[model samples]
Target: MLIGEVARHSGVSTRMLRHYDALGLVRPTGRTAGGYREYSADDVRRIFHVESLRSLGLSLQQIGRALEDPAFTPSALVGDLIRWTEDRLAREQELLERLRAIDASAPGDWQDVLRTVELMRELDSTSAARRQQAVLARPEGESVPAELLAGAVLAESDPHVAGALRWALARSGGDGVAALAAGLRSEDAGIRRRAVLAIAEMPEAPGAVAVLGDALGDPDPTVRGHAALALGRQGVAAAVPTLVGMVVEGSHDVDAAEVLGTLSQDPERADRITTALAGELAAPTADSATRIRLIQALVELAGTSGPEILRRLAHDDDRVVALVASALLRVLEERSRTNRADEDS
Candidate 1:
């Protein structure tokens, strides 16, 4: 029978039949040479499963993924769906309470309007249970759903949520780097900060690099700081360009310079490294503290490069500066002696 006949007999819409067919949920018992769908009794049963799930508030997309392959565990989706529905109910209840207000004509107020705005923003930002459930409703291989991600941002106010998300991106067997990166733009500063940290820790993925690279430019200093540190962790030479830009922009020159030093053995960019340290040393806003820290770090890690830094600080006019410089030089000298001794053995 054709789809219209299946719709009449099974009481499932022809559109749904087409969608289910697309999902491999129901195939015609046989297709006409012309490719029109021809359903059988088994097809009707598949449609029943799909319709039943949809009626239960499962989106068509979710129902198709579930019943298209019964192996698709509904358990995978239930917890997320419940959270989304509950959140919606809570918002509606709050709206209803406002509507019952006696003095204000029971219409929309500024608070309601603002809440709605936040609701929309949340739809764009994170991937909490509510957010992720919606993503699950999307077609397989589809790019991430923005609204679904927004709900995840709402949960970011809780530090534990942000921590979990960070850990998930870095540690979980899931796909959510993009979802968490979306949190960086959240109106909530703390959420953005935590999101950056999470993004910072994600295993090196193509999108992860780009997302964290962009985050390094976040208007928030804390976010920028986290981004700088995260990119350094990846040790990708590509991040060097973005880090350089941040320093040039004055977002955090000292940190950027330190991170540049942290870049993997980019012996080819020795000049850039030299330029960065010189830039930091010359930055008018760069304080004595930042320079001292940078020099100490360079002395500790850069081997031969440490000599110049030690030379400068050890001989500086400032007595305190010279004392710290002398200490670092002694440490480096002792290490050199140890290495020479090991060689003799």
Candidate 2:
């Protein structure tokens, strides 16, 4: 067969076939006495195999290596190629995810895609060993373990991995969701903290919400803060009442302020939250530090409620009052320029 016949049969262009031949990636078998290149049925079969592997997204180097040994049959090479293809597909998915995450943060740019592809490759490879471990164990049970999944999730620095883990947990069944939520209930404070952070990004399950509520009373104020913050992000309105009820009832003023900061997004919820926090701020037992936090939440929550709350906080002897007041004015001023973001839409 001629090179053109082989190219036509294999779906490769003649130019590409010649280029492949030049690269030693794939080559024709022999030449005619008159210097015409010739190929056989076997050559066509090899070209087809090379084309198939290239279509599978393998590098030319990989295709060449796979075709080197006489003992390596097409079926065997394809089996190996299948595994590579799966990993390649996974990397593509991760790239899409990272691009989504970046686009969420800012506008799309060519640089973002380039950075995302790099990050995606890193994430896909990082979790491979842990996924292999999970498959190897099988656990005498159904789906994979959460610890292995957690390892897979934490292996990547990108926020999209967190989102993917959360979605994966939700899809696996209620049990995976339950185990992930249960992580927030871990006795070790550090574990609880990390779990709260991870699960916060996870889908908000009722089980997870319940665990977060329990964690709100964690001995470490940081844990309580994380729990409240997670609940805010998860935003089950049912959790809103619990977060608010804890504010007037406890001394985790910083944590309470954070909850109020988030809940302030809802007018009805903000009124209830600030009303309770106001009482805490006014009481004789409240410290100057706690008062600072309470005032900050009031400032953050002050939509139409701004001047009234600002007047009260302006009286505080603490110098931070001035800084907080300045921040408020700055936010309003910056809005004049950056707030025009809607215009670009």
Candidate 3:
């Protein structure tokens, strides 16, 4: 076949076929009457083979080695090509994600586009400080999309940066909650913990309470604890059970106690809180430490009703518990007297 015919047959341009010949990748075998290059069947086959290898992302030099060097092993070159392709693919995928985030932000001009791009870069920066600045550096009237903020919060390890991201998400109008909710269901325990922490910071978010309510049953203690504390502060009575358990286990018991006390302002919830604490204290298998922690929480929930529980604990078998409870009882008595005096005045 002539070069033009070959180009027509193989879908390769004649110019490229000549280039292939110059590179010794595929040389025509004979000359036609016009002294033009004419390809034999084997030459056309080689041209097709070179095109096939090129399709696999082989460079011309590598293709030459693949076609001509009998001693050359393709395994190493193929592995290299695979790695190169994977790297290119990763870059493309990352770019696609950045574009998606920017598009989601609905940038109105080149400045907005640049701002979104810079923010995305900074959010992924190695320096935690840069990531934090990216979150806080929002231009007036412009904001980072919540999905990006949510993604950053879930992956952020630095406490300060994570806090800033959470703040940003909270103010982003709750669009990120859906994304953060997905993180709540992540199999990675760390991601799940971060998700709950971020969501807990956005109590005003739409459906934030419901998302947190689901996290109350998270297998991870940290997740459940944070969810319980946030929900308790939000006045969700469902958190009362976990808040009471936190007191027994000594995990954030102080915060849990304070939240429980706030929840107890309602007469019904107050009874439930008091009853739950007393029941845990009376468990036959309750260890001394657990009982002691529970006692401290009860003092935080101090009222006319809990003095009886404190009085009983004051004389208990555990000397430490007795001493702590007796001290708390005295403190509770002092506060009660002061309140009565004020009411009389």
> Best candidate, lDDT-wise?
3
lDDT of 1 by residue, 2-115 (tens): 888888888778886787778776778888889888877777777787777777789777766775465787675888889989999999975563433212222156764554
lDDT of 3 at 198: 88
| Candidate 1 segments exceeding 4 Å error | 1-154, 238-264, 269-271, 283-286
In order, the Cα lDDT scores of the candidates are 0.62, 0.61, 0.89
TM-score between model 2 and native: 0.42
List RMSD in Å for every model shown: 19.2, 20.3, 3.8
Steric clash pairs (candidate 1): 122-150, 123-147, 123-150, 124-150, 125-150, 126-149, 126-150, 126-152, 126-153, 128-152
Best by TM-score: 3
For residues 229-308, write the lDDT of model 3, one tens digit per residue. Answer: 99999999999999998888889998999999899888888889999999999998889999888888887774566888
lDDT of 2 by residue, 275-338 (tens): 7667766789776656656566665563556446656565566668646755664565466458
Question: Which stretches of model 3 miss by more than 4 angstroms?
Answer: 1-9, 28-48, 118-142, 182-192, 217-219, 237-241, 265-286, 301-308, 333-345
Q: TM per model?
A: 0.50, 0.42, 0.77
Worst-scoring 10-residue span by lDDT in model 2: 132-141
